[model samples]
Target: MECERKYRSRALYKACMRAFDTLPVCALVDSRFLCMHGGLSPNIRIISDIEKLDRFVETPDSGPLCDLLWSDPSENFDDIDDQQPEFKPNNVRGCAHFFSYYACRDFLLRNNLVSIIRGHEVQKNGVRFFRKSSRTKFPVLISLFSAPNYCDTYNNIAAILKIDDHQQLSVVNIEAHAHPFVLPNFENGFQFGERFVLYHVTNLLLSIFNMYSPEELAAEDGRHDKTGVELLNKKRLIGTMDRAYAELKKINKITLNLRGLTPSYSAYKELLTRPEIKALVNEAEKGRITSFDQAIQLDHIFERRPHT
Candidate 1:
């Protein structure tokens, strides 16, 4: 009733049908970091199940959830609930069960997986992460999107996590995309369809460009002193996605000297590389994610953000 009035679409029937059909299965993924629409196109890989739901927020039969969103997440997380209203909703609304993560946190203390990571909310200025429990300090939030021009408001983006050879969970909330092959200063940010296409276009092109033999790579330089110019350009394009890849491959990295998250590297890799990741990102980009998938979605938002 409200959405139709606000957006003036009589397609509620069509929309509702779409939501019920898809969301139930998309919330079960395990990811260290997530973004609304960052994962799309062919080159970018997005993890689907780790509860990356940007579209499922409820109407509350009220105004937007009164819970607070951080303005300077890193600097002000302790004040999360400070500015929040008396009424707030638990913003998590995807397939990844908040209760399940609660279960996993305690389980990791005895089992293998250590921390759970998720990202898909407003962390004003782009970054704003939190650790679930100090008792265990296991489940954590790691996100990045600092300096995103894509957003009209000043947005700060960030990311989390890294792994060593021993397969331990090390979370890192970075300020920007991890660009190894591009320039330090460049413009980029959140985009849906066509922008996503360019992202993958640039990514695949770079991958293929890097695949060329040393002589072939030198051929480009032979024509112009682009070695310096080209490397920076590549990083500008591959920057964020590069970071996403590094942290994602820990479970299955065989030659990279990186830690293995799960003993079964092949399975881990297969899960990580699934096309569903991009699908999930696309879902978020379109605001199609919803809680209809859940028997009961997480619906409680504490008035105050914690300080632990």
Candidate 2:
């Protein structure tokens, strides 16, 4: 029975992967709008370029297929003074490259596409429209993330894009509904009740013992001189733990904000070398920067620098 179950699971996994392999990497809507999971790839100049990729195999680490599925639109593309390139390394994703607005525009112009629709990032709103320039009638790119209240923490609305026969596009936003809370790891009610009772009883006994213990009384009398310092240190430790917990929550938030945004431990160490990010960390340590959103902004860190 066990061997049969294992074989069935493997077969199911392969079947799912095969289904994924059959899907197109991109689509053209009415010969106007190009749709993909991620933004443009530098290697793909025309629609036929995407068609040439072998979709039957597993996705590669780096290539046109990888870029089409992993790339993102550069945040600094609109900065005229920066003169950013059409494509640059995507440090956030650790693979593929961030495509600039100009790159997307050129691709759309070359392919006779009016706009590009993609979904790889979470937006506060369900949809985000890229900046429009004089050369295009519509926003160059539209990002639509359909997962509502993403991962149950983002509290972000979800949306779906609708296209009618006339090729008119409309977005429908959705709010998340409340669901029953389940204990972590699906712990059962009886086990939870037992643990709760044991915890309170143990704490109560410990408190009573501390109140009456002969050793504790002796220490309280003898340690009067160090009491103030010890209390101050305890307060400091508590403050430190609270700050650490808050920062931990923020880290979780940032890591889940979008796909491929999570930095490795090595990346964090490397970022500390930058003076700007270092200053922000210092401010956070001093409590000047209370919110993670304000303290850590990745856009400036990952901004494209012009070639010297």
Specify the highest-TM-score model's number: 2
Q: Rate the local accuracy (lDDT) of all candidates.
A: 0.35, 0.68
Model 1 TM = 0.25
What shift in Å separates residue 131 of candidate 1 from its native position after superposition?
A: 3.6
Poorest stretch of ten by lDDT in candidate 1:
294-303
Instruction: List, residue by residue over 236-278, the lDDT tens digit for candidate 1.
Output: 5575665555444321122121111112334435433556543
Q: What tens-digit string does per-residue lDDT give for candidate 2 at 105-124?
A: 88888988888999987776
Cα distance off (Å), candidate 2, residue 300: 14
- Candidate achieving the largest lDDT: 2
Cα error, candidate 2, residue 234 (Å): 23
Off by over 4 Å in 1: 1-21, 24-112, 132-139, 143-151, 158-308
CA lDDT, candidate 1, residue 185: 17
Q: For each of the candidates, give the backbone clash count.
A: 30, 0
